[model samples]
Target chain A: MSNGAVILQNISKSYKTVKALTEINVSIAKGELFGFIGPDGAGKTTLFRILTTLLNPDSGTATVEGFDTVKNYKSIRNIAGYMPGRFSLYQDLTVEENLSFFASIYNTTIEENYHLIADIYKHIEPFKHRKAGKLSGGMKQKLALSCALIHKPEVLFLDEPTTGVDAVSRMEFWEMLKKLRSQGITILVSTPYMDEAALCDRVALMQNGHVMTIDTPNAIINAFPVKIYAVRSNRMFHLLNDLQSIPETEAVYRFGDVVHYLSHSKTFDPLSITRHLDSLSHTEITVNQSVPTIEDSFMLYMRKSDKFNISQHDN
Target chain B: MTTERPKVIEVKHLVKKFGNFVANDNLTFDVKQGEIFGFLGANGAGKTTAIKILCGLQSPTSGEIKVAGFDVYRQTNLIKRNIGYMSQKFSLYEDLSVSQNFEFYGGIYGLSRKQIKERTSYFLEKLELTNEANKILKEIPLGWKQKLAFSVAILHHPKIVFLDEPTGGVDPVTRRQFWEMIYEAANEGITIFVTTHYMDEAEYCERVSIMVDGRIEALDTPAMLKQQYGASSMNEVFLRLARAQSAEQ
Candidate 1:
């Protein structure tokens, strides 16, 4: 109750025996761009639904903008905005109608908050008369965001906002998010794209209903404990398999065309590995040390959690 | 890879007009056999319209079109039989179980019931969805659902498979897994024509065509497209082409 924009304290939720969220504790500062990143079934949307007052956590307490989710749901709803993962807008309504409808529902007029959504609205202005169903994926995304911001909410929750959008649309959308963040809007966006984690001020990597790590993107990447190398050769598929079987190799998985591997050595010599691979007839070899990315850090974290689970099972 | 004369698909002066709006304006391209071709565009960029025509779903307003060694207009049924389609929404039934989804979709693709069962079991086992056979589709997580939908799309082992944003809403890992499945299909000599908003996914395709405002703005391999757009990534290539197209207009 310290006037934090969003607060989730030891929240727990389950559907029958399947635990969706477990002891989730997070506090988002006012006007911070926070990201919840993980694969599907990672409980990101669950946490979002809880904090936004759409669904109640079975235990513990959560608040948004100084209002309790359960006790002050009405107030929380009034101040917060949410764009669900699915396209939930009225398909029969025109783009303009959709915008106005959402604005009116929030007790505001589109005209009153035109400036807030003008940048996005301008793209879809000519298609204002078109039905929401007819809009393109990118335009639909813009319209959804504009509708979410029409009432000028202090906190916005976007669940995988760029999931199906084109790469260009994704870039544009993130740029829009950054602009909104500059205007003092607290954004909590959940995405499965690890690259997008860099765009946020800070991110919480979630998995299996738990927050694995929370830090700035750079901090997260910097915090990766292992030495990483990008390894590619003519025989990449077989090379990855071999690297996984190596004693020194911690993780070996395909990263784009090249296979990225982590060695359990701070002083892992690049040429020695190259020569070793060369002896195995892996030609056109390009083995170089590269900085750990968000994916690397995420993998490292997942591996640790998996090891812990395995040990616990044995015990 | 073949320098031979017989192209798998050849489109010349293709035009598809929906009322007054021209969906495809004099588009032309050649798709080689066993090529993982990408039909890429912004939403409303006419990529879907062109693909629909090629798949013999919609008759072009006026064009010379040939697919799978047949005319598009007259041999539409044959074309449909020869090709498979995974729409952006896909073709999975929400009420069906994982195995039922395969049976239904595979049956529609004209596979024998026995073949459907075998393919279903093999794919389910391959995808590690053996335990989820009885689970309803809507009950499964999105990543699993997406993969299953794709598996059903290629269930019949058609000569070609048209995928419309197959990895939408899926996690990165799922998307990667989906692409590997696509690559596996391609490796088996199935011509893949996929449309995706994810440029990273485009890199998996052997060749891609970028459509903007009812016309192809660029067509090349991912590396070539990136180099032509003078960008480091396929995402930037899309941005540059889209921007260039808008600026030209």
Candidate 2:
């Protein structure tokens, strides 16, 4: 446990009748880039709050860099840098002023840790004189990241830094994170984007206040229980209904241009799918064995979890 | 011979300037009736400015534009009446009940009480939320709220519906379901003008236009764009265009 830079032991939190997190357990090692991959209301924010010492969990304990979140909150706060989901900086203050203010609160000067944020800061350097509110969305994100690193904390927690950002900017933000990781900082980030899960060293797929699976992105995809076929035809719109009608079909969902069809049996043949679509008067029908992505795994896990919840209700 | 569909959205030499900043510059495009047209761009790329103009929420400095066959400048009210809009930031009233939110939006669109009651029940049943109709809006899950918001947006049965990042943070299953709803609406001849950051959703559109630094850099079908850019997916096409703009600066 001492080797873990951040550790949570059976953490559980609830808001009135709603269970935000239930029996969550995770351990993030030092200098490792970890991701909490889930959608809204998946308890990502609540888990982050518990780790950052902002909220007390109803059960269990968490530690950041060997400091207990509850008993040693003062020390934990000093070594933990957190960027909330929303932009929480002062709107009236200029970008430069905001950075300096954050540094001052930690009893440190921006110059003392200038190298820590030098890469990200350069992107927003030209807009230092502008008010924080006047900056664009991408620029605001860069500035927020720079402020979080200005104090050079031992661990960083970023909550959905690229939630609404464009594809190009998101790519750039992940690059920044990799650079930070190379400098030996333990980083824990959360995102609703499944594609981003692949970029992390390891990810915990969460849903409904539970951790469905935890592993590297490749392992998670390889562990998918059933085979998935990418099916497409001339009539793309009708493909969903036609595929679902097939007796072997277990689940069907659209992925970009093709409809990803899962079978109830693991030994399902791609030829059968093509034959089914061909009989429906569909032309240019293509059925290919596709690789399961993190998204595919996430959806499968979510379905299993839903069935489990339903069975639990029955009992 | 098949008849050609009429153009529902037309923009020629559009321009909007705020002081020295040119938010939209010389944009021109046409959308056919019942087409799912995607408007995509990076942050601060002027997508919002152009959408505001089309939605009749803001006046363009100089543009010859028509939405739903109404002039953008002179017939703003008429255009507003013919279109529905929903954004991620503002969609429904969380303080009200699920049915109440529908009633309020329906009333604002000038529907009769009887029409509101009938449509509310109809949609609630379709969403399988008939039992939860009296639940508070804040109590429902985010995915349900989003689906409800979309249903409410089109309750007036407008000629066009504008969606701005409608599936931002929903689970993958619900996100796909939301797109199914969109497909159903489009099948009924309701024009869809949507903006999203998800490249997969961009591929779902009949045609997509990507903006970079206040200009439409590329506009074509997903397959055509991929071939033109020598990319395998829409995500590559977007990164190529947006990254080139930043590199130039």
- Backbone clash count for every predicted candidate, in the order shown: 0, 0
| C-alpha lDDT score of every prediction, in listed order | 0.82, 0.91
For residues A41-110, write the lDDT of model 2, one tens digit per residue. 8899999999999999999989998899999999988998999999989999999999999999999998
User: Judged by DockQ cut-offs, is candidate 1 incorrect, acceptable, medium or high?
Assistant: acceptable
State the lDDT of candidate 1 residue by residue for A120-190, as single tens digits. Answer: 89999999999999887888999999988999999999998988666666878999999999999999999
Every candidate's DockQ is 0.33, 0.61
Residue runs of model 1 more than 4 Å from their true location after superposition:
A1-3, A91-97, A125-134, A235-247, A265-267, A306-315, B1-6, B131-135, B138-141
lDDT for model 1? 0.82
TM-score of chain A of 1: 0.94
lDDT for residue B106 in candidate 2, whole number 0-100: 92
Return the clash pairs for model 1, or none. none
**lDDT per residue (tens digit) for residues B35-151 in model 2:** 899999998899999999999989899979999999999999999888989888899999899999999999999999999999999899988899889999889888888889999
Chain B TM-scores per candidate, in order, are 0.93, 0.98
- For model 1, give the RMSD to the true fold: 3.6
